[model samples]
Target: DIKILQLSLRSADLCIESGTLDLSLKILERAAVRVERLEIFSGDDDVPIGRTLSAKYYMLRTLLAWHQTRPDLAEHMLCMIPEEAINNDLQLASELADLCYNVGQQAFSKGQFDLAAKWLEKAAKHNSRSLNAGDENSPNVKLRLIILHMTVRAYLEQNSGESRTKSLQTLEILISYYPNELAVLILWLEVMMKQGNPDHRIFYNRLETLVHVIELTDTNIKIILSYIQKLQEWSIEMCVRTLEQLLLRMPVLSDNEQWIDRLFVISIRLSTSSGVADSLSLLDAVATHLYDYLMKPLSQTTANASLIVRLGINP
Candidate 1:
């Protein structure tokens, strides 16, 4: 049965390569069932043939879903494989990574960002082997960078803590590659905010300092403002603290006038969106704070601001 299943897997792969996935799917599904039978005896692991069959089954399932316009399902199928099993098997890792990297590209083309992020993160998790000892300009290396970039884009759309934390390593590598990329810097700020309450000053300081950098163009500023809007929706209190901290740091970082004017621009947009009257607008809170920042800069430091030491103590 093992021999028959192995033969069927090879034939199924040939069918796949020949652009006959219908036939390939049938063969692979049957072979998968047979593989399960073999697994019952081999304890489902570490036996070379059994592991090979199991990996091939899941990998083909992923591909079948990928080519069928079910990228979300493809991602889910791949995640069904145990990370430990994939990590220990080179063939499994490569197949999984390649399938996901391709699926992410297709998802990006269709603007399915959430699905793209899930697959791209899985691709990033594995397949470093192609990049591990190769030329930096190799096709695989370029592909990995492209995946990393798209993963950042997709992660931005979702803005979840788990995805942000999972992406840190690849993101740090990307940041090193594009040191001045504003989007990457924005992602770093979000990660810092979620890292811990004790590190809030560090987040505010980096955000303030980075905004003063030459890369903070109108588009990037808009992106940060949008993030602030989401933060407001997610936690009104944290949003207020962010605005207050940014106002406090603006004076030391650059001309306070410029930052205040930017806030006014953002306030106009927020007003336009909500059609709120001027008397009770969001800017009123900011307006009052603006007065405090201008009139009593040293007197208005919040307890939160005073506690943070601005990158002096690492998070």
Candidate 2:
């Protein structure tokens, strides 16, 4: 009976491959009936046999759903297969891993972030298991890290308490893998800020060290400016300190337009909010710096005009 059921399923597979979905469905239905009858007739209750048959059945159904362009149905069918069954079949495991990543990306593009996170989490698990963890240079390992990063982003977009917590945990794993990576560190900083982690100052210091070593590129500048804005709400004192450090290095920055604009806004806002002498002094310093920047070119023009006047042609 078991052999008959397998042959019936194999016939269904051939039918499916030949694009005879109706015939395939009929054969699959017959196989399902046979499987139930075999259980009754054999009286052995072969759980492994049943599970293997079920996995094959669901996988074929999933393939048919794909051929029909019913992605929703395909994903549903895949979910119906038990994990143990998938794990027992190497090909099934590989197919599931790839499918999970694709579906996760599709869900993310559709703004279904929670669903994206769910699928991507599965992809990460499969990829991590298949790839050697210690081989950081492996392309597959890099892909796994990317999947994990996407998972973090998906959880972040969901922004629920549970999702934020999940994002934070994923970020921690990513940071462990690439400790000096700017994007991951910044993301971690944001999640910690949102969670109101009291230990943020430590992380902030770590970010500061990384950025300083990397030497104030546009990317670094953008993240620092973005962060200091948010940090102001948490601690104005720390915000001022960071701004001071940035301002001290102003001459070294390649592009200061955005920096100067936001710095002015932040300085004015903080000075207004605190209404204290120290805040006002910081504001004054910012104004003076801005004046120097704006006036430097004018001063050069003035010097050129004075030289022309002294040449004294009176034409």
Q: After superposition, how far is residue 64 of candidate 1 from its true place, in Å?
A: 0.3
User: What does the lDDT come to for candidate 1?
Assistant: 0.63
Candidate 1 lDDT, 1-315, residue by residue in tens: 877887997888788778898998899877877877776777535376676667777777788777776766766777666555676776666777788888887787788887888778778777675455636665565666677887876766666777656566666777776555555566666655554442544454445545555344456556666656655444444444455555555655556465555554444344334433441234445556655766754332332222222212211
Candidate number of the best TM-score: 2
Candidate 2: stretches off by over 4 Å? 1-72, 79-95, 196-198, 209-215, 232-315
